[model samples]
Target: MNFKRFLKWLAPVSLTAILILCTIVQGWSAPTAAQTQLHWYGQSAFKLTTPTGKVILIDPWITNPVNPNGKTDLATLNRADLILVTHGHFDHVGDAMTIAKKTNAPLVSTADLGQALVESGYPKNLVTLDTQGNFGGEISLLNNEVKVAFIPAIHSSVIASDGSPAKYAGNPGGFLVTVQNGPTIYHTGDTDVFADMALIPRFRKVTLMLACIGDRFTMGPQRAATAVGYVKPDRVIPMHFGTFPALTGTPAAFAAELKQQRVGSRLQVMKVGETIRL
Candidate 1:
């Protein structure tokens, strides 16, 4: 081979080797069966099962904010080994405390929000609070291969009770969940698409990405599509839309943009109360 051609091929090979080496050192290796499955509930809620039967829930809101539903009550939902709250927003945290109390699920929320929940009559013992501003920190659960990390998201947070503000939780964020026996799931709570999102890499090629597309409160479809490109998950599920009249965003538009970006095949539009197996 010519010198120039050999150097070009060698450069690409070297780059690939370096990336693989980094991934191995950082604990990203062969994906197991758990990395192939994920399930999404409406909005920013979902259930992820590890290959070892571990379940993790992210922002489990299953009711209407304007009018609560009997079936949507989180207290009666299935057992959750780990519960993640992206922020202190009421909609995102509507049923966290109730579910935690009922299932004795360890809540993974910010310290500020955990204290606020305790003060507002939530059980203090159920919370596994961690809000020390450690952006990329991971919390390994007691059972199951479920691990959760607090990722950065540009949004506001508040804790209220009986129609009054109880606490002002600081900046909102999202959860990057990784199941040792399964796929990595990223649930973006109410947030605007920020540049830092590309910093986090999923362990198992992100089988499911639960994203918020409701404008006014969160990023619109266009910005959300851009975020989809950045995260580049295997499948993207649009949520946090069509619940309210003020929130004007739709999954169809998101899908269209994804198509334009040549990622339409990865877009999955899940209806409220509908579940998609990832």
Candidate 2:
């Protein structure tokens, strides 16, 4: 146990201990609590609040033909701690940039999508942004308790103009969001029930799922129910329905299918502007 040799061994060990301690302090004590509130603004838009009060908005397509009075259109409803875009559809990004400009929130999306937004009129100076592509990659926010993983989905990823081909923006995707204190939430932006749905991270363990059951464009009630059966989330919230008359699928139909398939108990049908707390 010579003095020089002992000191060399102790140095690395001490540094490792300090690093681990710092991570724990930063993740737990730095924030008084984990996220606690889950608010559904209809369709795929939702507001999540960590116990420490950090806000996260997902696929925030608040105003459209369906949600005419959506918070996105409301001037007072600006600002968020973080914003996530599942894909490049207009309904999912209508008010994202506006809210970011007003609140200076961080935008979490794919690199290609973020760049496209910047080119398509989003303010480049008003917000922070994080873009991570799908599978395994995660972004830790709100003191690291909340981790967001971009998951795969079968959907379109184009910003088309009148009579023009869809601009190849990027691949369409979904989100697998885990909140430390509450339920893990999944927002499947207009998608079909692909085999990959079963492979998405945190599948079936989700507490709430914002699913698209609008048939003409996405999966119909029967398929969505099957998607739910595969995901087996603790609860499911049907969305992307009733927005257009062509979208004949309804929550009622989803509910009936869920019951027929023994999943009705987990379905939570939210009103256009209702909030669901998990």
Candidate 3:
């Protein structure tokens, strides 16, 4: 073969290799409209776009401190099929009302927290009984494309707005979101390490884990690493840290601890306002 033909053959092959490498390093799949996409808005906020264009927001704190474009993202979001709030705290419940009002998204949460959100002005119709569940219960959402299970968390929950005395909002919790033809994501909400986490993978293999590494309020690097070991997800992303002075834990520290603990989970450090395909 002549040098010209050889070069032509190498070009597409080289491009394919580069794309694969990028996917491995960046935790991104091949760019396609039919792929499941995940967007992080700092803190515990996440938007998941399913393959069929259904949108689900988890702990929709769009205006958190770490997110610079919080307001813009909030305003531009025109569609939200479902909104899942792990608890009724202000931070975790951030912007849920605004988004739900605009998109008519149903709120998936424990029954007590759902009632509290409705009382706090969340759309009553949207917070219907179908979406409300308890711990150890799973609800099929978005035409069965996504299934969300209410998981227990070691945290407190209260709904307090405008300093008007906190109201009891049942228990804090996390979610196990299983996406069809996509990844099974575990959002750890704001919880410390617990033994039941070990039983999570027994049900379904976790593709991604959104874990809290913020020390003061939630699990630090060490405890978070232990939690990761229990679930053993395919990839782990650290969150709920660095938005405030009190949340001192960092992804760097979390990575070191994962290594020290001999946890085999792959760590994917997501930046605020970043999106990745799964």
Backbone atom clashes (below 3 Å) for every candidate: 4, 4, 0
What TM-score does prediction 3 earn?
Answer: 0.88
**What does candidate 1's lDDT look like per residue over 26-119, in tens digits?**
9865564443345545566666666666666777765545324425545457677777778887777767777777787777776666666677
Q: How far does residue 260 in candidate 3 sit from its true spot (Å)?
A: 0.2
TM-scores of the models, in the given order?
Answer: 0.78, 0.79, 0.88
| Candidate 3 per-residue lDDT over residues 161-258, each given as its tens digit | 98798999999999999999989999999999999999999998999999999999899999999999999999999999999999999999999999
Candidate 3 residue 20 Cα shift, in angstroms, is 29
**Against the unseen true structure, what C-alpha lDDT does each candidate score?**
0.71, 0.76, 0.94
Q: Please list the residue runs of candidate 2 whose C-alpha ends up more than 4 Å from where it truly belongs after superposition.
A: 1-35, 71-73, 125-131, 160-166, 201-204
Give the 10-residue window scoring lowest on summed lDDT in candidate 1. 66-75
lDDT of 3 at 29: 60
Better of 1 and 3 by TM-score: 3
